[model samples]
Target: MASPLEEKTVARLVAAATAAPSMHNAQPWRFRFLTGERVVLLHADLERAMPRSDPDNRALHIGCGAALFNLRVASVHAGLAPRTRLVPEPEDPLLLAAVHLAGPAERAPDPDLARLYPAIRQRHTSRHPFADKDVPEDVRATLREAAAREGAELLFPGPWHADTVLELVRDAESRDVMDPAANEDLVRWTRLGPEADTAVDGVPEYAFGPRKRDGKAPVRDFTGRRPVADRGSTSFERTAHLALLSTPGDGPADWLRAGQALERVLLEATLADLATSLTSHALEDRDLRLLARDPGSGTGQVQMVLRLGYGPRGPATPRRPVADVLDVV
Candidate 1:
């Protein structure tokens, strides 16, 4: 067994883990550090779940998986080797993962994972527009490698396939506009006016990015027809740099792997000086999600649609205090 670690050290690791992105910035995860075993437990906070938007809890698993990945990265950065097991307890569905943090004497830290530590806090979802420029082939290859490391595939769609995916996103958006029930989750999670200034979880009005003026990027406009002060309209890139992240399976374990792959890709993109945004609006609908898959192979379930380019990086959004999410026992 590994020696016990300081609670403050564990709290810092949990803080970095919580920095991972979620469906709507919900931060739907809790961490428990078992001092005796030197293990950290990641659990899903069902209260933070979205039923209408993500009825099956696929996105929930993905978000928690991202947190798990961050915990591993933070551990490596802090001279600990993290051994992670997803869904360790078959009986408990919500017990997402268990990570044993071993000291360097037991297992050496992964240098590659440690290199990504800087990007953890640097990586933010940029809802703003990206410049019209092609991401270099080398950078794309690097991103693909990052995803593959976590047992996922990252595919950059060609022009025709990109157009098909955009159409599906628009179709999903129109459906959201028509369905009042669909907007319920949006209203509850979006912070406007004074709430944006103090809210710890959920997407703030400022992070919504500008309303799409004349671009084809599938950036979600959180405001809809509602008005916000000083929020101006801006034109986004005509052709978005879109990458589809997919896994071989469609189960809870696969969702967790996809989440890890998603964050890995995001972190690598961040280090590459690329601003990233996620478009899951289309993936929210089961049929539209199926249509968003790679047209070439017609295999692998699509988990996320990532937009990458050079533009203004988004501001850091709020996160729940580490004290609120971490418990040491």
Candidate 2:
């Protein structure tokens, strides 16, 4: 077999990697390619970290982990076996992962990874209200499997559990309102008016969807007492379809795994024609996070709360240029 990786192939992989979601669209990741070794390195861009909101840098690591997952998928799609190592260097905390591009005698993509290639670009976070409808059990099973592949659990909470989780989100929202440090992060990461039109990062005004006029979805109100012209109000779904992504341990490694699982489940949901939005707000706090977990099972740390249904898929947000995030050697 010939060389499995070239500059162009690596560039394509990096593009897909850059598309992964970050907390508040911070997009905190950097990539380096060692052509001699055919290894791609993932690093955390500390400059993009939300110091106030993500004090522990858990969200930052999750974002980088998501990017690493995309690289794996993209590599497979390009007929190369991707061998990934998370936190390969304990001495270098910023180095999140290293992926080797292997050229085997038979060069072919993993069927499952290749299957998700199309959904990578199709999946977007939909902040708008979803139509009140039930997601089929088969689809739920697919999502669960996706999470399982990345060593995480996807749980569709019961009605009582969902209510409790929503309450925790509300409590979190109140905390944000009261905490100036929290507001600082939102204000830093949200773009309004003309700023949203040209910004390369941060949540744009158009992507925020309509202000919640009614209903209880754990969607964060990014505006947060700020005013935006033409931002109208709309009623969200009454019974929001909520799924929690969790891992047995809560640490940098687990956060990375959670992020990979998150993107996998998201791609699966998109393929199932389900619109999705994420809520890490509730799980930001330690006490609130515990309250958000499964009362019955009482295991694992909830990484993200995803609300999925049929709705308008969110508009594509901007990302830093490929050259900005990648360095090829």
Candidate 3:
């Protein structure tokens, strides 16, 4: 039987995991705490999957990765050492991970990770423009290291590459906007005003930054089809610091690893007081995805496109309650 303290620790971890960001805040994960075995099982909630945007389950894996990171941090805070086995059961496809809790390890918590735990609740994806200030080279290095520690590569593309990627994003935006089915699917998940209160999933109107009336580089317009009145306009950064997250392989396991690394990098950036947003537009297109890979290196597969800089924080998106996501049995 698990001790009372152990049970409490598991509960706390669930709370932390729920705070993780999801694509459109879908929160598409469920947890089962096995007290007798001192293990926590993470499963994907297929019902919450975004079929239109994440048909291949990339974003879903990314969301789960964010939750997994939270669980790890919660374990640290609760004085437990979490040893995780990713995709422990292939037979059960929904089962993503089995985290076995061991008693506290002697090693101190990772100072960088510990510093980011508080920011987990504070970090928001900023769509508004970043100031003209360039992100220092040292900060970029730190962020790169953060991603590396989690089995992902963070590459800052040169201006020419960035421009190429930007054009691809514009293509994606144009396609998504013109396709009625795609727009409809996005509209279904978006919530506004009173609808926001009832929505357990989807992006809230407040979280959608203002619509650009003029020509601005494409940011995923969550509000493209359904306009949100009173959305304020702001000048976007002319020069954005863009980084790509990549993995050595492209499989379910690789995706899970990349997802974990993505959150680690994001949290680290958050702790550094940087605002971040992600675009997988280019990666979503097969030709563009192939182009993203460095032909000579032959090792990395692009997992995400991240934009990082200093900017005003966006509003906090909603999450389902801890009780809703965690099962005591």
Ranking of all candidate structures by their TM-score, best first: 1, 2, 3
Model 1 lDDT per residue over 191-242, tens place: 9999999999999998988878898988988887779889998888998999
Tens digits of lDDT, candidate 2, 3-97: 63678788899999888889999999999999888899999999999877788998898888888888888888877888889889999999989
lDDT of 3 by residue, 37-130 (tens): 7788999998888777778887788789879988887777676667789999899989999987666543455445556678778778877777
* Candidate ordering by lDDT (highest first): 1, 2, 3
The C-alpha lDDT values of all candidates are 0.93, 0.89, 0.78
TM-score of each: 0.99, 0.97, 0.93
RMSD of candidate 2 to the truth, in angstroms, is: 1.3
The most accurate candidate by TM-score is 1
lDDT of 3: 0.78
**Every model's Cα RMSD, please?**
0.8, 1.3, 2.2
Q: Considering summed lDDT, which 10 consecutive residues are worst modelled in model 3?
A: 104-113
Residue 278 of model 3, lDDT score = 80
Q: What ranges in model 3 sit over 4 Å off?
A: 1-6, 105-112, 213-218, 294-299
Candidate 2 clashing pairs, residues 3+ apart or interchain: none
